[model samples]
Target: MSDTTRDGLADRFEENRPRLRALAYRTLGSAAEADDAVQETWLRLDRAGAGEVDNLPAWLTTVCGRICLDMLRSRTTRREQPLSEINDPPSAVESVLADEVEAALLIVLGTLAPAERLAFVLHDLFAVSFDEIAVVVGRTPQASRQLASRARRRVRAAAPAATEPRGRAVVDAFLSASRGGDLGALLELLDPDVVLRATGEAARLDAQGERRGAEVVARYFAGKAQAAVPALVDGAWGFAVFIGGELRVAVAMEIKNGQILGLTAASSPAALAGLTVTPL
Candidate 1:
């Protein structure tokens, strides 16, 4: 391509960067990863040479979509630990969008299988045709549509209520026991097979990736939540820990039969923002 041609293509690519990054973020749920995906798309476009492309926007969109789909697949195969912060600083657009992409929504996305996430993100968020998505996911067009449909249903079902005081009471009780160093009380609040999973900063603090059994779990939190307070985690009972009035940690619980079945701590900015806490 001539200098003019290359310059024109570059301009077009730059014009589409924000949209591409947004699409990738929605699919991968990591701003840094989305930036990487968009960069890779640029590389591919350069190597292919833009002369043959009839619709630059559509072509770029498809390429970015396929790249994200592969990344999602690799993430599944490796069971990669979820990170709280993006590698890159948020641009103005990203910061604005991040606020809109509630922590609850990301939590729900975590539950989806990779293909379902890609299908849902591409078709529903970006308006990519199912036929194009089929190529990325190795599914037929009809199958791709079905995949998105299932994801949509799951997202809808996962929406949080404004309040569930029962959950709040449980979280408060757990926090009180933790602050009081009441191991027996902690054990009483947990199920026999309770599980504790920590991600982002919380995972590093806990040392191990997960802890099991009521005794082990109780010992870990026996006196840890001195600064923790009740909060709504995606509309469920949870707690938040703050330092100097800045939110630092969010704890989300899974309670069943009035006992703690599972709990998660997220120290990432995204997770912290999703938490709804009362004044200290």
Candidate 2:
């Protein structure tokens, strides 16, 4: 392509990138995969004659939708035997909304057909018209609306009660107990069969890969708190982590009923390289 053609495509991408990312994120529920989908969409546009397209935004959306659909279709097969299976870590949005929903919601969304998920996100979340969603999802406008309606019903039926302020207080207490190295208090807050998992680069940095059960996690953090200084993470009341003074590891938590149900610690030096820390 000529320089002018490349420049035009770049401009088009810059204009529509945010919308494309939003669509991908709502459909996939994974920030990293959404980023990859957007990158792949741009690569495809570059290879094709996108500069000649009159509706660049629509063209990009169509291409991105197709790419995401393909990924959703293949996701099951990939999960069955992934070369490197990484769980989707909570993005900032997911973290805020985590307490409002159950793990079952994530599982249900993951099971949705791509077209259904796309239609729902566009119409419900993004407020796109069925006509526009129809184009992206490759369905009739009525069909798109119906798909979105079905998805909405499922979400509503399964939605958990909103997380109350008191629930947040419990989470805060758990963080304080963990930071103070109070093993007894920590155990009191946790359920007996609590399961803990981490993802992204954080998983590798974890000494035990992934720890499960309340007792197991309690022991793990007890050892860490005994050895290191605690630091506040992400400015959230419930977020806390341990730093070796030389390296900063970020720790995020999900608490329920005053128990630490889930914890994610990013201890990889590489993951820590770009982070800024706050004193506890």
Which candidate should be chosen as best, given lDDT against the real structure? 1
Candidate 2 has an lDDT of 0.62
What are the TM-scores, per candidate, against the unseen true structure?
0.56, 0.50
Tell me the TM-score of model 2: 0.50
True-structure lDDT of candidate 1: 0.75
lDDT, candidate 2, 53-156, per-residue tens: 77887788778888888787778542211112324344323432334443323434554567887787677666778888887777899999999987766555
In model 2, what are the clashing residue pairs, if there are any?
none
Residue-wise C-alpha lDDT for candidate 1, range 181-255, written one tens digit per residue: 899999999999999888777755446778899999998898788888776555455778779989888777887
Model 1: clashing residue pairs?
A: none
